[model samples]
Target: MSRKLPLLIAIVVILTGSVYYYFTFRRGSARTIQTFAYLRDPASRPELRMNAYTQCGTAPFIFPTDGLVGFIWDDSFRPGHRHQGIDIFAGTDVGVTPVIAAYPGYLTRQPDWKSTIIMRVPDDPLQAGRQIWVYYTHMADAQGNSFISQQFPAGTSEIYVEAGTFLGYQGNYSGDPNNPVGVHLHVSVLKDNGFGKFTNELEIENTYDPSPYFGLPLNARENTDTIPVCN
Candidate 1:
């Protein structure tokens, strides 16, 4: 027991701290790397961002979260840079807000960042049979080890999950504990090119309009509802 004191302390720290990383918006340079950035509408608020994050444009999909909240799809973050994904503000803090698998498929974390989760849904209608990779980032509660990886581990870096399986929580922890973003979920999807390869999500052609994917209007700048999902 004495020799294992260090291990015990680490476990307690993870359990108590909730293990959130917020390296930066890039999910850390080494741990990058995906989308979900938008300019906030002055008329509305952050809730709109959350709404865009969860809802798709039309049928065949619904808002991933309980309901629409702060902000959503806004491509004005940088000049000529269109936001490829929707930003969802789901949690009041770090560990409490859980994000589920949008569609059942294989689960894997980003290259260097365990906080950034990538899910491969192999049966996307948009893709003939190439598969779609749902990229989930900004997990404020993710440490070096991922919730999905910790729960399901194998030799390969691939872990399969159900359509609505519990992926992890929605957080703003990027890749370092020192940096924290606005505390939201950056969700995006990409075309899978087989062999576990995926197209670049930042490239507009490489990304999908999550609005149609989630069955909601992400471009709602008219301000109808606004609440701090990140509250």
Candidate 2:
């Protein structure tokens, strides 16, 4: 009887160990399978294009025709904050320089390029309420005429701009040229999702800081051959 008891105990221990091993292995395998499934899902793909092109023009140190001085935060504009966009120096000397689209997308023209260009990226999935938009201002004619373009004021219906397509010219319309500074292309980006998109609409509306997106400085000087002719 004593010998039989040891045998029976050994059998029970073995069975218990086997059961533990089975459950442990099963759980680990299940986790691995779930991870692989998540990786295979198409919706989890990355959105940013590393080598994508910008929607602005390619000219020899010339101003973008989209005439813009800088951007002002909506909060800054309301009361005593007093803020504005970063103005890229587009000297009055080079008036009406052709502005081109930085990237290929649908163009939403503002009353003036002075402050907005919403670009819905071609194949990017909707990021909730984050839509990319660019803004430019401080536009004027060679004769120094500065006024918000008469075409569209609040917003326009639709305008197609291919990469490098002409938009408009640069000028010093934001304020007097000499009082504080000269004309410049104030470039900025705003993201919108449309739902409660009204709040926090402009994400990174900084001054002409398109370096990360376009791989160039705000005032990049391209080769003469690439520069467009003044028309």
Candidate 3:
């Protein structure tokens, strides 16, 4: 009976571990599972590619994270509401998820409304210097307000960043500080309106389809891809 007592205790320990695995690891959150799978093989990620090809142009923008993501570029979600930018959803979100600088450019922060970060990338790299703006927004804060100013209070002063610079974590601040658009990042590209100021992103018409903007695999399906983002 003494020998059997030790065996019984071992069995009980094993059973407890199995139960924990079943509840905690094996049956993890949906986002957690997706994130893991995405890191293992990114090209198989349909959630990130759902409307990436069909709707948001054939350009597959760089997968910004090893984390699982969902692309919401189609503004058709609501009538009369033209979403000018694309929203990328990350896994079981925490506040620290890094939003990478999509291109090598100068970054400036507008501490109004959504607290937008605009990157000015070179337009005519081969010729005389010309620049274009890539607008990114919804940087997260518990207050649902300006995280950019809190981090770098330099305001609109230009700060140069490379393609992989740590822009900030995913944000959701819209206009009201109390309400966020959710845990995600919104991005758009802008064209100069010829008056020395860029077109407003709110117009939808002013923004370019981000699909062809970043070095996305535009129209090239069947390629599992990866991109270098910030830590």
Candidate 4:
């Protein structure tokens, strides 16, 4: 049949160029742009500042137990709804301690994201994926086997965390402390309301309220939000 019609038109032109290279080059090369002059966000759009980053707040602190950051939607699953991030109470064990990189860049992974640490800032070309995530939900079992050291049975890795190093330890993995009472450390920061805003898969409702990027300055017993004058 004419050589099977040129092998079915070369397998439909290589499956239509792999679905047009997965939406124009793998989801636009997993978009990344915020490249540290200090992870910018001066209220976002100033023509989207292609440089001079400065959301500067977290760059440091990652404690796993100093408590008092609150924001828990898992108040046994949603008693009052709020939890977008920040928990640190680490008590029930698994305290191998050392999860940093509050401000650096390039390290991504997302498998329903139960274990995460993303910080991308490819030199502020308008801070592309403008990321910042650190979620280790009650990670017992030797801090989830010391965060993907290798042996990927579907564990996801590329664990390069350094800007404060030590990315593992502190467990409870977000539940079951005799019906949930203690063991914390949930720290988080990931604001996404730009770049084609999202719909659902809940990035904390497209986050953007990380207590003013954790620069700390609200004391009515904390959590009044918006306090990042990062200078």
Candidate 5:
């Protein structure tokens, strides 16, 4: 009886550990795990790609770039860290995938910004009378060399760009050359400050879920398992 009890105890411990691992790692990072799988085989998902300036279903905004959406808005990397935007992995070498404007607006690239741009939408497409800002970043190499188009230079502001306008290419700039991110585009829909400028984009509260804009399930919390694709 004593030997049988010991075996039973060991089995219970093993089962408990397996459950803990699934809930802590697998379930918690299901989206991220699936993203890496898609990155390895982007061609497997075709519904996500369409002609530039074309929207999926009733989405107001067009697909900004062709790639597998790796991460999504509100995705948390750790405790108290919420991702502010959706990361579209190009699944190609840096500067190979082209990124375009999702909608028409006044584009601005700060003077010190090496791989970032912001577009001001006078009226939010989802909400009338409310202004929003479309922010794009990671358009640079690890060394901070810009990949943005020559048409919009540093300090360029208030330039009206049409939807599908060539903006730049994706890169792996993580601000630190030693720890460069994967080649991808991080885009967010930012809330406009009452002063007619964009609010802090790093904060989750200042960003909007891109689902309504792109008409896809771009929120990480909602979609897990597979890459987001239009039905």
Candidate 6:
């Protein structure tokens, strides 16, 4: 038995490594299977596409863009990384899918920002006596060319825009031309700091779960196995 002990130990090590790899990497791939499939055939699901200025179910806010919601709020791609917003994949060529305002607010586009915009809502529709901000990004090309509408050019600030106003088209900008992300719109509901400005949106603590805002299952942890669709 002593001579066979080494082989047994080797087999155990191999099995253990396989299990670990399955859970670590393959599990993430399994989780995103639906997302990738939706990206390939987004037209298969019609309910997932909400038009601009239209509310899903009883949600007070309108859908900002039309596409399959491939990622939801609080989705984590890796350890210690939580996505702060929902990513709506347009399944079309860059700059072909239009993104619109989900709510009426004051829009601002910082001068140097190539792919971002923020809207300030003076009165939070969900919370009383508090302000909030709707943040959108990834609206530029891989080379940092803006796809935003020409009317709201760079340095736009405090311009009141009604719901359904054309904001821009989706792009695959990830701040690096060589490493562009998928063509999607990242929209987040940001909490306002005590001083009337939006807090850091990168932190999940500063962003709210968009489920209640859109009246759908938009929390990644809760809405697995399929892209979020309006019922």
Cα TM-score per model: 0.61, 0.42, 0.59, 0.24, 0.85, 0.85
Ranked candidates (lDDT, high to low): 5, 6, 1, 3, 2, 4
The per-residue C-alpha lDDT of model 4 at residue 206 equals 43
Which wins on TM-score, candidate 2 or candidate 3? 3
| Local lDDT at 68 for model 3 | 34
lDDT of 3 at 111: 50
lDDT of each: 0.54, 0.40, 0.54, 0.39, 0.85, 0.85
Q: How many residue pairs clash in each candidate?
A: 32, 29, 5, 21, 0, 0
Say which prediction, candidate 3 or candidate 6, comes out ahead on TM-score: 6
Error of 6 at 3 (Å): 26
Q: Which 10 successive residues of model 4 have the least lDDT summed?
A: 28-37
- Which parts of model 6 are misplaced by more than 4 Å? 1-31, 44-48
Tell me the tens digit of each residue's lDDT in model 1 across 1-231.
899999999999876555322211222222111112222332333333343224343344434443233344434343345566766654355666667766667887645665677777767855456678888776645343353335633232577777667766666675665666765667777866557688887776677766556655543232122322321
Give one digit per residue, the lDDT tens place, for model 6 in 98-167. 9999989999999998999999999988887889999999999899899999988999999999989999
Displacement of the residue 21 alpha carbon in candidate 4, Å: 50
lDDT for model 1 comes to 0.54
C-alpha positional error of residue 229 in candidate 1 after TM-score superposition, expressed in Å: 13
Question: For candidate 4, lDDT tens digit of each residue in 175-216?
Answer: 333453344456555543345222232445544344444444
CA RMSD, predictions in order: 16.6, 21.0, 16.9, 18.5, 5.6, 4.6
TM-score attained by model 2: 0.42
Question: Where does candidate 3 stray beyond 4 Å?
Answer: 1-74, 124-130, 149-151, 215-231
**Local accuracy of candidate 5 as per-residue lDDT tens digits, 1-231:** 987999999999999988755544443276677677667787775665444556899888998987877778776666457789988887888999999999999999999999999999998989999999999999999999999999999999999999999999999998999999999999999998899999999999999989999988877667644567777
lDDT of 4: 0.39
lDDT of 1 at 86: 67
Pairs of colliding residues, candidate 6: none
